[model samples]
Target: MVIADLLGVAKVAAITLNERGRISHWDDTATELFGVAPPRALGRPPAALLRLPREHRGAFEPGGFGHVWCGACTLPRVDDGEPAEVGWWVYPIGGTPGERGVSVLALAADLRRLRRDGIGITIGDLLLAPPDRPAGDAAPARRPAAARLLRVEPALTEPSGDGADTFAA
Candidate 1:
């Protein structure tokens, strides 16, 4: 069983697709996220499950590179409940030569809490992509509007060795 399946939570989902865009793995989290069980989603086109927009669907094609896209939007469900507004990230996921596949990793949290408190966590230098196209076709694809690169540094300061020092000096 995958990590999501073992956890049995609906907060995160993971899916892998091949050159043909067929589903390779669909864990429990994915089932809850998309509302489609593995038996039904497996072997099906990624578009069928996600129903991505036409322009965005092309980006999911296997082996296609040079762009990163993301959005903070809501996902609609047919069940008798309100739609879910989520923060999502999407990008190409392969580095092997001649390999063609894209992996989409998504994490969803309560929107209310986010709106009230903002993201309290500190994020380091992030490599954000420009909104416009790069100068030349050879130029690396621009980062998506929502993309942010965070550089995290470990907190290494320790308490002073002095007997009474309770904080780092």
Candidate 2:
């Protein structure tokens, strides 16, 4: 559905953030969802408008921002009514992080309706949080130092028609 929305097969609210993480483009759909027109939304960080949690606050930092998919997050409406749960995707464009002219495209959809449609969508669907640990403890299950430096690529080869798949790297 996210892919469909991005391809124009479906419609969703869209916002674009500049390299410095200030709003650059705000679409009508965005105004409908957030209840803030482009005049008030532009030139401001999303955190200043949305009720973003601490973890998601990094989305406004160019140094830490990356391609992120937030399956469900609550954002307060402009009228201060019940919060709206929505799913969003953030993707950088033009250049990589720290590069000039880089901008981010954010697409958001209402999760309540998504659930009503029996889509079975869940929060943190695409995000994998690091395992929690007790205080002052090293992370568990870390790869060996040597393994961290290793690079592996699958070898491409023609199928031999043996009714089995083969991969070598």
Candidate 3:
């Protein structure tokens, strides 16, 4: 059965950034993903908290243009320095940074886990294509029917012996 028939990515962590590109909210998942708790992560710029790739160094900066930027990143855990491969999608909220400013929501997932689970996701799949503008404003890209569906293993669709018929991921 199709698990999801839409453009989306699995997110393992959620972080909210204020207009200044500083962490405003860090959820429990964020703590687990980055090993940085809210107490130490809040108010800190993403650059200071995570080691972004050279090309993506400006990922968290307010681009003045409100858009969704998604890709992969490798970051060392703040607590142990252990590296983690993370997939990310960053999008602005409220308005562009130049206008009234806005809060940005950043969602990340562990790539290793996604791969192990047989989820075929990629940056290109997430964006559909390199976005020319914010995901909401841009016209959806046209793609083959095969590309729109995510195939799920029978184990995920098969219900347990329990009375509830819920699909487990």
Candidate 4:
């Protein structure tokens, strides 16, 4: 199935942003969630459509596209009731840091739903989880290093009467 069809059925908004923060692919669910249809929003700067503040707009810099700039940004629902908190995932989409054609994918979730589901871990809590190392303090044994050079004597062409080949050092 096509990506557009997949996005439509998932009920999750999928937005693709260019290096300059312009909208590339604004899927169906994105239109429903943001109330800005593709016909009008495609190719336009995302900051303008979302009404992002100047300070926050810098988060879309090509190098910073996919890193989580703001874990949550509160905005009123389209119907205009209580504000909803939306988390953002920001990081560079295409190629390395300085390459062109970078894109950003923003996955937004309703904070209310998250709270109802008991998502309580803070960023610090997640980052500070116990380090994955053994608790024992025993030091490992070290093997002795071998000398790199080895000397060998030439073998004598004639064998000794004792039937042993003699080697001269």
Pick by lDDT: which candidate is best? 3
- In order of TM-score, best first, we have 3, 2, 1, 4
What is the Cα-based TM-score of model 2?
0.57
Candidate 4 lDDT for residue 49: 69
Q: What are the lDDT figures for the candidates, one per model? A: 0.48, 0.59, 0.66, 0.50
Cα distance off (Å), candidate 1, residue 112: 7.1
Off by over 4 Å in 2: 1-9, 94-102, 117-169
Writing each residue's lDDT as its tens digit, candidate 1 over 77-107 gives: 4243446555555555655423434353333
Clashing pairs for model 2 are: none
Cα-based RMSD of candidate 4: 22.1
All candidates: CA RMSD in angstroms? 15.8, 15.6, 15.2, 22.1
Query: Model 4: per-residue lDDT, tens digit, 1-169?
Result: 1111111011235566776668777776566556667888888876766755466676655554345565667655443434656656555565642333546766555555545443221121121111221446233322212111112223424546796534422
> What range of 10 consecutive residues in model 2 has the weakest lDDT sum?
1-10
lDDT of 2 at 89: 73
> What's the lDDT of the predicted structure labeled candidate 3?
0.66
Question: Which of candidates 1 and 4 reaches a greater TM-score?
Answer: 1
CA RMSD (A), model 3 = 15.2
By lDDT rank, best first, the candidates go 3, 2, 4, 1
Question: Tens-digit lDDT track for model 2 on 1-91?
Answer: 1221111112357788777888887887678777788999988989987877777777655556665655568878765556888778777
Query: Lowest summed lDDT over 10 consecutive residues: which window, candidate 1?
Result: 1-10
